[model samples]
Target: MADKEQFFSNVYDVVAAYESGFVGAYGNPEAAEALRDQIKSAGGIPDGAMACSTYKLEETGKGKLSLPFLEILKLYPDCLPGGAQGRGDCVSWSSRNAALGTMCCEITSGIPDPNSGRLEGAPEVTTTARLNGVLSTEAIYNWRRHGGDGWSCAEAAQVLLNDSGLWLRKKYDEIDVDFTQYSARNAGLYGSRTPPESWRKIGENHRVQTVTEVEEFEALRDLLANGYCVSSCGSEGFSAERDANGVSKRKGGWAHALAYLAVDDRDEIKKLYSEPLVLIQNSWGAWNDGSRRIFGTNIDIPVGAFWARWSDIKNRYMVAISGVNGWPPKKLKSYGARGFI
Candidate 1:
């Protein structure tokens, strides 16, 4: 059996490969609504969404490697495979979001005084830094080229905050920290700056649900505030011992994100994720360590417990999800100092 570290490392490499196109990940550049319409025209929800293959479904009921999963591909017909203007399909975001979420959960399972799993070179901005203003603007520029609403960084922050249950009830730029802009900035910056916009709103009023304790659901709640889907221990909590079958279980709110798709209530929620929901996209690869599902949990950060780096989260065990198909590109693998990819 592989060591826990090796297992996660392998998972990251595969996820990264899929995202970087090493494994033929595809998508369309059309708007999400458009793609949704196309799927509806084709045959409604695809039966293969649960298969875990990064391919598209054709009318013939066959699977082929193509851009955009069935759900979001149909809408973005113009979205080509590998280009500056390429837009990610919904599956792309789902996979990436789930993998990252899972990694976070694995490492932050328990609050270590000095957290592990932080990115090495991320800037250590103060909690109240105004860095989000720049990040929100940058995200708008990046996402806009791919066919998103021409939202400003500030606007994005507000949306993120509102989504996370922060109650950001103000117009763009009018609110100290916009949820839309802040949510994007949080993931992109990885907590470097909570966006002064958020700081101002949270100033002296650091009160949000499920954050003070740093439990699984609590951390997930924070992730939800930022606009990412979350899956976790399902209130089952964490356990240090492997189960009777030698499988480790994620009991409580371990901070992590794995890839997963949301489903309708009428369907038989398979319950693959954690306790609260079904399905979890793991960065730890195929071998299940008994973790939670990857959908319908909170992943937004509460206003107060937002940590700037993995270290800020005050836990050990850095979990990484890669968008590459082969070995992940990390500092240790860099042989030369060219400083260029």
Candidate 2:
């Protein structure tokens, strides 16, 4: 930013992501990843990753939202025990609970993209979610906290990939939490250190199989468009107050993590945000104001979600996107035959 730089010193073949062939609107899934190798070889945003691609709209994926997550999250507000956090466990909340939960729901009960006009085919979520809802932040936070206030998304991802697998809310199959219902107090207490071995064993059954960083904005869009979830930690700051269209403007930088559940790159929203907006689901429940209206539609997004412009997220801010097994998302153990009371 301070100095105008043209090239990157080297190139990196980014690790592949969501290889089941749900590449965004792009023809080749590898196109965005290929741009990376040359950038490091050619250097610098491939002639500027931020500026060069501004307003490069994807007509197909405009206004993508995770409706399964929205309805389920609201159906069970108990899934979010404490509305806001008094400690620093956002890394777990963002990556584990919000991001992964969204992906899991999409896999298990996703409706055809809303644009498909097939809302009638949505799945029955009452089997597991009616009781405990989704993954527990209490089970996830402490492992990454390392007995401190903060942790990185990568550390949290490793815990999911190799350490302890996912732990559904306490009501169902809890990890190490002492109480049953989602507990903010428990989340704060475990906000540090690696979890106990028992937690590791319990979590394995539901662990996510893949998590890779996304460099290209559209690639990240594809992940969400195709029903994947992403968590990003960065220095970017944003306002809690949203505009009429539900867009949040840059306020400064907050060294924290948050989950992105949806992306709206529709050509029409530009009149309001001037660029595409990604809906960020914050760890602090009901913290941001204003409601999100799907662009060009009368449908209103439920509370607890807000939109952030892409311009605010370009470059330097790395995104960790994730997905589960199978094209339609397999049934996990948390809700195995023993599911529900």
Candidate 3:
């Protein structure tokens, strides 16, 4: 409890300096533990699950998958995922919107740049268009957020799995309700209280099936290298806006939830930063667009997104991989594919 207070105090101090009015509430250590117990009981993540650590791409059949970077933005180019607009509904935005959308894109479109000479994803579901757009941030946030102040990534995962199920923009018709497209006002307005019951049930088809707790680097990379996406919430803040490399400077404060949509593990990037970079998508709408190509790669640093080093985030960042409904999709060949590494 003492640590949690100190954590929020630091957040107030750090973000207070910036004019972006960025509010950070990633839930403290105490909140995480309580949520973890609840998550396990709800069957979100198993008692002893080791998914990515045990995942292996068939050595002989799939061939060498050379990934200079795992770019999710390349898969789904809605760089600005609507925006949090100072709301604490980041868990909803990151979990359902960025993470789930990108994973669905991968499953439908295959790797952005498959240098492995094969398209690997569920091509059978290519006709499914609803999974391609931005989900309703308020639908989940309205139900799971703790009074619009904060919510953990795990809690958001639970919301996606069982509680409220998935709900996309009314345009996508992810649910029965005519939940209009997302906006800063609607997210803030409806999310201030519980949502109507009619907006709860996930579309009969689109639902997150499995949630895996991933605390290790190898595990994160393994899942990302495939077609899955990971969401995270941690107690940390950036000192300044993103630099030329698109890397946000760590300020050592803030409880914030965000998503890791891509990974930049290029040798050149690692050599310069001393570790790989994780492409983070923030809920803040176009909050920071200052970026440059660290190397000769077409990795688009979206408006609301930035990059962070693995060394800096490995310890404090808590993440969970959300596997979509269509698991183990077909591996289409990327013979003439355009993979953005």
RMSD, every candidate, angstroms: 21.0, 13.1, 8.3
Model 2 misplaced regions, further than 4 Å:
1-82, 105-133, 171-176, 188-193, 325-341
lDDT-superior candidate, 2 or 3: 3
- Candidate 2 per-residue lDDT over residues 1-341, each given as its tens digit: 10111111111110011112111111122533453443345333322224224424233354554343454354354443234443455566676544444444544454542322322222233333433335556666656444445556656655665655665444444443443344545765543355666767776655555555566777666556655567666656677688887777887556666777777766577666677778776655565676567666686554556778888876433444443322223354575577753
Full candidate order by TM-score, most accurate first: 3, 2, 1
- Pitting candidate 1 against candidate 3, the one with the higher TM-score is 3
Q: What would the TM-scores of all predictions be?
A: 0.21, 0.65, 0.69
Winning model by TM-score = 3
- For 143-228, candidate 1 gives per-residue lDDT tens digits of 22222211121122222222222221122454434423234232232122333444334322211111111223223222332222
Sort the candidates on lDDT, descending order. 3, 2, 1
- Backbone-clash count (model 3): 11
Better of 2 and 3 by TM-score: 3
